[model samples]
Target: MGDSIIGGPRIYSCYKCRNHVALHDDIVSKAFQHVCSGKKEDRQMMTGLHMVADVHCADCREVLGWKYEKAYEESQKYKEGKFVLEKYKIVKENW
Candidate 1:
């Protein structure tokens, strides 16, 4: 038999926006957390944690725009440097 190997997928969660996005865990924690949000909730009888996304205000649970881990990173980068926002990837968009 060939070399049989098994590996788990990397999960990411945003800290501020509470949005969940799946990406390689090899990334930095600060970058990961800044880019990912939401809690890792189980959807049905799953073995791994399913990173989900949620849109709401930080102070209040007010319905806001679409939130994702990628945006988290974009926001941080934008704030740090006076750059444009079109470069970042907008995964999800809320009405």
Candidate 2:
């Protein structure tokens, strides 16, 4: 057999780490396991808001900033395995 298809709207890659995360996946639920019961900083950072703000790279573990609505638009300009421009999107504007 081949790989099974995971149902979701679409997967997105982290700009810093290139880690792929499905939009429909339970990212908040997963991050909670690490964010909670960890350090005070992490717990304070998590706030446990579910979708409003929650995203981290599973690879490099870099905390992705808010504004996921524009991830796809930004990623479209670059190919996979490409480096994310450091200066781009500093203002954290939406797509």
Candidate 3:
């Protein structure tokens, strides 16, 4: 079977902070840098004890989504090395 839906490229930005997060068809996740876990900072958690960090806008600091520091399941090990963008926190812009 082939993909039933065909769509154009999407640009995702933070809804609260209006910061450009990613281009859906392009780079989806960026590298984690200087992330801290606390009330005012990016929240960090563990999925089955695998570290995951919630990312936020650099300027306005709105919660965007999370980046997996380690993979919880062996089958999903690829996610361990990348970021996961939240759909609810982003707006899609299409050209």
Candidate 4:
């Protein structure tokens, strides 16, 4: 957890520790969580209504944030299959 990749793609790490927390990339890829996801439910976000699943860290089991499972509004469709990490809990790793 302490070792940093010499020339790795820049990622986000937990501010509280050197734990691999999240990835900050332009590509909107579906997060493959072999670990786990909380129950899927619809919630009204600032942007719009969305069905999201709470994502958990496999290593430390912390509440990383959520995955956008489904977007109800057409304008918010792009957010589907993306993640939302807590801004206050993460820091750029290699940037």
Candidate 5:
């Protein structure tokens, strides 16, 4: 596995409810326990594909981002097993 350091440890909080959901470095491209809702196909502006679902803050129920339920591309299969964090929907707190 190739892991790139985006940054140091940071707390990711929901933009709407300010509820902490995940850590910066811990996020992947797949579903995480307690961090994502059930799979739903939706058209994403970023990916321009219909294979994502909303991730939410378990406590506040704020929409964070989408996880790949079905990968649009074969190379994106790795993303099928992780959760993609939306930069606009979350706030990062450095510790």
Candidate 6:
């Protein structure tokens, strides 16, 4: 998968800005999207049917995560309108 690699062997930064950063190493963390934009569609996920919009990095235009447009399942209702940004694993080293 795509990972930030602006030197430091594993230091990750925005593919475009290269200032703000995040790390990727098989760890997936959840995030919410407040801005940026993507199209919405119904997609079958592990949880169930979800109407989601792909959240892309404003700087890179890369699909980062997703925005839950609507959740059909009652239990999953809490996820509605929530965001899950690009999954990443943070690493520590020379900075």
Q: Please provide TM-scores, in order, for all candidate models, with all chains considered together.
A: 0.19, 0.29, 0.62, 0.70, 0.66, 0.59
lDDT of 6 by residue, 1-95 (tens): 34344554344444444533444442243432223658899999999999999876666666666778999999999888666655352123334
Best to worst by lDDT, what's the order? 4, 5, 6, 3, 2, 1
TM-score of 4: 0.70
lDDT of 2 by residue, 46-94 (tens): 3232212333445665554432212223433232122221233122212
Determine which window of 10 residues in candidate 3 has minimal summed lDDT: 34-43
Candidate 6 has an lDDT of 0.61
Candidate 5 structure quality by residue, lDDT tens digits, 46-74:
55454777887887777777666677766
- Deviation of model 6 at 31, angstroms: 9.6
Minimum summed lDDT over a 10-residue window in model 4 is located at: 26-35
Error of 6 at 50 (Å): 0.4
Q: For each candidate, C-alpha RMSD in Å?
A: 16.9, 14.3, 6.3, 4.5, 4.9, 7.3
Screening candidate 5 with a backbone cut-off below 3 angstroms (N, C-alpha, C), the clashing residue pairs are 28-83, 29-82, 29-83, 30-81, 30-82, 30-83
Point out where model 3 deviates above 4 Å: 1-9, 27-48
Of the candidates shown, which would achieve the greatest lDDT relative to the real structure?
Answer: 4
Residue 74's C-alpha lDDT in candidate 4?
Answer: 97
Worst 10 residues of 6 by lDDT: 26-35
State each candidate's clash count.
8, 0, 0, 0, 6, 0
**How would you order the candidates by TM-score, starting with the best?**
4, 5, 3, 6, 2, 1
**Candidate 3 per-residue C-alpha lDDT over 1-95 given as tens digits, one digit per residue, 9 for 90 to 100:** 11222554455677876666666554534533433222322233453445666677776777677666665568657666577667787786664
